[model samples]
Target: MLMHSVSGVLIILVLIATGYWLTVQGWFDEHYSKITSKLVTQIALPCYMINTITTQFTRGHLLKILPDLQFPILSMTLLFGLSYLVQWFFQIDPHHRGLFKSMFANSNTVFVGLPVNMALFGKASIPYVLVYYMANTTFFWTLGVYLIRSDGQTHPGFNLWQIVQKIFSPPLLGFMMGIVLVCLQIKLPPFVESDLHYLGNLTIPLSMFFIGMKLAQMGLRNIRPSKDMAGIFLGRFLLAPILMTILVLPLTVPNLMKAVFIIQSAMPVMTNAPVVAKLYHADSNYAAVMVTATTCFSLIMVPLLMMMVMRLV
Candidate 1:
């Protein structure tokens, strides 16, 4: 298990490093990164969701998974509330407070968490991963985005339509579409399924490339130790995983599900954080730094975490 975890994270790191190397070589830029992000989020992820959900899960499996959503939802809620106290203690700058809180509570469930879980636990872990993804996506889109936006210059009033649209993003819609098909017993034609599989294959590589692009743009030299950075590190690597273990230790769910949830909880900051920060005129550079820091740290944490999880579960 330890070797598997190390190798899994090493593979992801190599891909990210490849992207970093390419970007440094002028093979890709910010514009290319944006395109890659769009390709993954808009095109690849939805197809991947449909392909994975339809093939790996049945209606009964999804039904069983739905009840497990409570674990991640509750864990993130607690993390969000805890962020307030951390903010007060750390005296985080008012402008970056929202970004801090959102990053503190959310994880890169798709980009980092999914791949790590898949690599360590194999395809059987997909459904558990999606369960956590469902909760993480909902939290980030609604409360998380709102928090980041609040840090901006203009505080826009809440629009139900806007929140709804953000929550029902393309990837999520694809997940729902898959569920509907499963419930209805509908199967796609062979060619369509094959095409979806092909498109879905782009998600992991493109996501890694996007991360590398951002890391290259930010430059590791820019990261400095500070109260905010420490708070986020504590939240992502320590508080989140500990909270998840406490929540799942007594649950009757499969041990694999418990392990997946714990791993997902400890993933890096959301890749969307910096993008949203840029859009809202918040501290995007700060968000990017945290994302880079946590991602790099996670390579060290994954093997240790798998060892701990093996004992607990």
Candidate 2:
């Protein structure tokens, strides 16, 4: 199990290294990174969601997984509350307090979490991953976005419509559409399924490439030790996974679900944080540093966490 876990993470790291090397070679720039991100998020990921959900899960499986969503929802809610206490204790910057809270509570479920889970647990882990993704997405769009926006110079009033649109992202829509088809017993034509399978294959590699490009763009110069960075690191790598283990360990769900949920909980900060911060005139650089730092830390954490999960679950 230890060897398997290490090998799985090594595979992901190699892909990430490839992206970093390519970026260093000037094969990819910021514009190419943006295009790659769009391709994965808008096109590849949704197709992956639909294809994985329809093929791997049945109506009964969906029903069973739906209730497990509460674990991630509750864990994140508790983390959000914990963020306030951390801010008060650590005297986190007032200007970016909202960004701090958002990052503290949310994880990059799709980009980092999805590929890591797939590497560790294979295709069987997709449904459990989606369960956590649904909760994480809903929380990030509603409360998380609101918090980040509050850090901006222009504090716009809450916009329900905008929140709805962001929450129903393409990948999420694909998951929902898959659920509908499963419940209705509908199947796509063979050609469409085949096409989706091919496109879906792009998700993991493209996601890794994007991560590498972002890391190359940001570089190590941006990372500096500070109370805020420490707080986020504690929240993401330690508290988050511990909290998830507490929630799911005693449950009767499959051990794979428990392991996947724990791994997802411990993922890096949301990749979207920097974008949202820049949009709202908050500390986008801080957000980027957090993303890069946690992502680097996760490469170390994944193997250890997988070993821990093997023993615990």
Which model scores highest in TM-score?
Answer: 1
Candidate 1 C-alpha lDDT tens digits along 129-224? 989987997788668877887888565565888667656767778877888999998999999999999999887777666667777887867778
lDDT of predicted model 1:
0.82
Name the runs in model 2 displaced over 4 angstroms: 91-99, 108-130, 140-155, 249-260, 270-288
Tens digit per residue, CA lDDT, model 2, 35-119? 7767876798789878877887788887877888889999999999999998888899888799899999999887777767777
Per-residue lDDT value at 295 in model 2: 74
lDDT for residue 268 in candidate 2, whole number 0-100: 84
Determine which window of 10 residues in candidate 1 has minimal summed lDDT.
1-10
Could you tell me which 10 consecutive residues in candidate 2 have the lowest summed lDDT?
1-10
The TM-score values for the models, in the order shown, are: 0.85, 0.78
